[model samples]
Every structure is written in structure tokens, then in C-alpha cells.
Target: MSWKTVLNEIKSSDGVLEVVDARCPNEFRSKRLEELFNEWEKPFWIIINKVDIVPKAFADRSKKFLKENSDAVDVVHVSSKKFYGFWILRRSLKSYFRDNKAKLVVVGFPNVGKSSLINMLAQCTVVSTAPVPGHTKGKQWIRISSKLLLSDTPGVIPKEFASRDWAKILFPDDVEESAFILLEKIKNAEGSNFEELYGFSPEPSEETLERIALKFRFLKKGGEPDTNRAATKLLNDWNNCKLTAWWL
Candidate 1:
């Protein structure tokens, strides 16, 4: 769906839930979206999804940081895979809306587990979910409870992200360059375990891709390390949550 459509949906909703990846909460957040929510005068909350992979301390710190820095009413950390923090989220919503029913819109960048969270909350699969970016092609309104409704939208990037490297890294035209950028981010993040996850420490260089290619037996003609294939695999792993990293 287009950003204009998403904005229209948001305008129709009573509140907004901005789902973000717990592994890199700050990087995934959209300041422009927050500004829009504020301008619309809708209740806004930050849902930090995928807390199953990151440390609890990291999740807490992330929540605290967002609460301090953003305009969100509250920040909640949750693990959709492990079914954690659902009650708290529900309670927060209930307290805010009181006796009146509310229609909320869930928004976020691609592959941040919005659909999965919705499924977990509704206790069934109401929307399709996939590991890749832009898997949610359209919108669906789901009733999580008698008083609460949710609108699921396709992952969207705001206009401000057009110039950012991280945004380009999300839907990259060049996979190898994007992989290199992701590798550098992971290498620099605190508490990232490159060796534990991939069996070797990366050096933020093309040689790292070569090593990963050889290690995973991704080869091309004449037995050369297939850097493109290796980069694709690395990006896949990152998107699929097979690899985990967090920055503060």
C-alpha cells in the first residue's frame, strides 16, 4: 500500500501502535510517523516486538530510551514468539480507552512482526505473515476484543528515510552493498556475537563476505566465493531473525 493510503487509515483510527524490532528499536522507529500521530491527536504507543531474541535488559533500556525521547504515550516490549507482554499491552489500551471501543492502526517498517503480533493477540492467524520485507501486501481490520479493533497495514517507510542508508539497506537495489552496511552495523553494535552466530568474527570488509561464502560453501564458476549469494544469505538470516543484534 502507498503512504497516502496508510495516512488515510491512520486518520480513521482512534489510536496507533507503531511496532518496532526489539533488536534495533531506535533504527526501526519513524519520527515522521510519530509527528503525524501527534498532529492527528491520536493516542500513540510504541510496541517493541521480537524481544525473544534480545536480552531483557536491552528491552528495558530500549523502552526507557523511547519513553524519554519520543512522543509516544507508552512503550511496551513484547515477544510475539513467546507470548510475552500481551496482558500489559491490553491493560494499557483498556486504561486509555476506558468504556469506549477503539479502532487502532498498526504501522511499522517491513518485517517487524506486526502480523505475528496481531495473530498472537487474536489467538489465531487473521493475516498472512512472511519473513521478507513487504510481505503484507494489503490491509485488514481485525477485532482483537469487543472493545478493541486493529487495522494491519503493509510496512511503510516515511519520506525522511529516503536519504538514510539504513532505509536503503531495508529495500536495497544492491544486495552486496546493503549486506556490507548491515555487517558493519552489527560489528559495531554492543553485545553482538558475530563469532557465536556465524562461527567467525567479521571485519566490516568484502573479505568478510568471502569468508562467509567459503564457510557456507556458496561458490561460483571456477570455485570462486559467491559474494552475492553469501550476501543474500546473510540478509535473509538477518530478516528471518536467525541472527540477533542490538544497539543502545
Candidate 2:
């Protein structure tokens, strides 16, 4: 679903005190999910999952951004892989729902640990988690506590040019716009060096994009770089910040 649809649902839910974002640190920025949360007139918390997988640099930057944009918003870092920080997140939820008896919706992209975070919060395997994309295909509600109910929704890609808009939101007011652009450009330019550094030497004459796929081992059944599959793999990895330390 789009963030707009999610917001509309929250608005009509009759007093959801907090909106929880259960996305990886990089996705919270790349998809501009945090900006959507900050725009919310209602109180909310950012519950970032898969903390274990994200680099420390990204986590620190994300925390700083969360601290600055909205006082009502707090960032919660948790790793389902390591099962850490759920207690702190629960405390935040308890505080948000205190005396309000309101619902908290957990939203994020697919496979960003939304289901796992919800299951962990509910203290049961109430939600399903899988390694493949589009696992949580529908919405489910789980009660986190007596005063709080959490609604989990499937992941979505924004309909209109999500990537560029998201990049703008993520780098807002930093006064380093050109620097960010340059860095991204440099990363793409150094793709081959990265492959070699990782102990792989792809043919330079081959398609550069295909080289990326081959370097990452996203091969076809015929042991070739399936360009379509490579694109999908790269896009997913880029979204999840598996490409580089400063991937987001």
C-alpha cells in the first residue's frame, strides 16, 4: 500500500496515538518513510528493524535525523536476527498508548522485518516472516498490550517516482546536496573496484550492469548474469543497503 493509504487508514482509525515504522534503517530513508512519519500531525515512533544488518554509520545518521525532525518521534533500533531492543520498543508503545487506548500501526516495505517485529512484539508467532519478497501480502492486527493494538501491513512502493522524492527528503537541510550527489556518483563509478576488492574480477568489456550482477553472484540457471534478475537483485540490495557502507 502507499503511505497515503496507510495515513488515511490511521486517520480513520479513531485515535491511533503512534505510527510505528518497522523498516530497515536504510529503507526508512530511501523510501522517505521517516519523512511521511514526521509529516503526520499525530504522535508516532520509528521502530527500525533489522538493526543487526545495517551498518553502524547508517544507524547513527538515522538516529540523528529522527531526533531533529520531530520531537514527538523517537527512533527504536531492533534486530530480530539477534532479538534485541524489543523491550525498549514496547516501552515506547506503552507510553504512546497510555490513557489513550489507541492503536499503533506498524508499516514498512516488504521483508524489512515488519512481520518478525510484530511477532516479537506480540510475544507469539502471530505473523509470518519469509526470506523472499512480498511475503506479508495482507494486513494483520495484533495486540501488543492491554492499551495498545498494532496493525501490520504489507510492504509497498510509492506510485510516483518514489526514489528521487525519497532522496530529497532524506538529505533535507543538510547543505551538502552536491556532496551527496558526488558520493553516489563515485560509488557507481567505483563498482568494478568494489568487485575486485571483494575478490571477484568481472570482465570489463561486459555490460557494466551485468558485471554488477555477476559480481554479486546473481546468476541464472545457465550460470550467466540474468540481466532482469540482476536488476531485481541490485534494486533490492540497494534498497536494503547491501551495496556499500553509505548505500542509503
Candidate 3:
């Protein structure tokens, strides 16, 4: 279902569950959702999930950035995979709805751990989950606690432009440039060796597609680097969280 429709129907929603992938906080920012939340006067708590793979420094910065820039009542870093930080989240939720059960609608970009949050909060596997994006196709009501009801909706990703938009996505022709841009971000954030993560070193203006092609043995006629294939593989690796220490 479209987010517009959901937001319209839930104008009376007690709150919004704004889930975001902590590893790719910049990429997951949703201007549209923020606008809707503000328009509808719906209070939100930004849940920065998937904290296990990230350094605490990164997680702390992400939470601070989100809290400072947004009108969120609260922001908490969580890792459903490692069973971390849910106790604080649970306490916050319970405190928020001390007198009445609040009906909250969970929304976020694809694969941000919405279902996993529901499962963790309920302390059972009440919603289906997958490692892939768009795994939860529709909406379901999940009881997180006696005083909290969550409406888990499909993960709605912003429409990916075929061009570079952070790690959001890349246009086919812009794939190599996108890789360089993302690598630059990693350099600034983690300062990890790009070669260690991607299996090849990148030279200034040296094509990432070529490096990936040679490293992965992706070749075309005359043993030429299969650039298109290589570019797609590189992006897929990024999409699947394979090519970076700080991958989302």
C-alpha cells in the first residue's frame, strides 16, 4: 500500500514507528515520511536498528544526529540480531502508554528490521521476516505489550533514481561514480581499507568497474573486463551488505 494512503487512514494514529537502518543512516532518510508525520502531528520514535555490525561510536553519532535534526520524542539504537537495547526500548514504550495502549504504525525504508522489532518486542516471532528488502508485503497488528499495539507495514523504500544519491542507488552509467562516492563516505567515517573490503585497490580515476571485474574474474570477449556485469555485481554486493565494514 502507498504510504500516503496509510498515513491518511491513520491520521488519528497515536504515534509512528520510524525504523531506520543505522549502518546507512544518511541513505535511509525519508523526507516524505517526515513531512507526513509532521503534517499529521504524529509523534515518532526513531528506531536505529542493526547496531551489532557497527561500532558504538558510529551508532552513538547516528542517534545523536537523528535526535538533533528530527522532532522525535526518543531515539534508541537497537540490534535485534544480538538482542541488544530492547530493554530500554520496552521501558520507553511502556512509559509512554502508561494509562492507555497506544496504537503505533511502524514505517521505514526496506530491510530496516521492522518485523524483527515486532518479534523482539512481542518476545516471539509474530511477524514474518527476511534478510531481503520488501520481505513484509502488507500490514499486520502486533501487540508488543499490554499497553502498546504496533501496526507493522511493508517497508517502503524511496524510489531509487538511476543516478547517484548517496548509497540510495545508482544509475547504470553512474555506477562507478557511485562506488567512488560511497567509498569516500566510508573513508571519512570508518577509515577502513577499501581494498580489504572490496578485494581490489582503486587508483585515482581508475575505474571501479574494471577493478571489480578483474578481481571477481568477470570477463567478456578478448578477456576484457565485463564492466556492466562488474558494476552490477558491485552494486548488488553493496545492496546485500557485502562490500563494506559499515554496510547497511
Q: Pick the candidate with the highest lDDT.
A: 1
Error of 3 at 35 (Å): 3.9
lDDT of each: 0.81, 0.51, 0.66
lDDT of 3 by residue, 1-248 (tens): 67566665457578887787777675576767778778887877888887776678888887888889888888888877777777787677777778786877767665667767766765643443323234345445666665566665544544551124543443435666666665566655553345776666544234777777888889998999887677677666655555544532
Residue 100 lDDT in model 1? Answer: 96
Give the clashing pairs for model 2: none
C-alpha RMSD of each candidate structure in angstroms: 5.1, 8.9, 5.4
TM of each candidate vs. truth: 0.88, 0.59, 0.76
Q: Which of the numbered candidates is closest to the native, going by highest TM-score?
A: 1
Local distance difference test, candidate 1: 0.81
Question: Lowest summed lDDT over 10 consecutive residues: which window, candidate 1?
Answer: 124-133
Q: Say what the RMSD of model 2 is.
A: 8.9
What digit string (tens of lDDT, one per residue) describes model 2 on residues 49-163?
6666546666666667666754544677786657788778767766666667765665554445666776676564243322223434544556555555566553443434334
Off by over 4 Å in 2: 1-5, 14-40, 109-112, 123-140, 154-157, 164-207, 210-229, 236-244
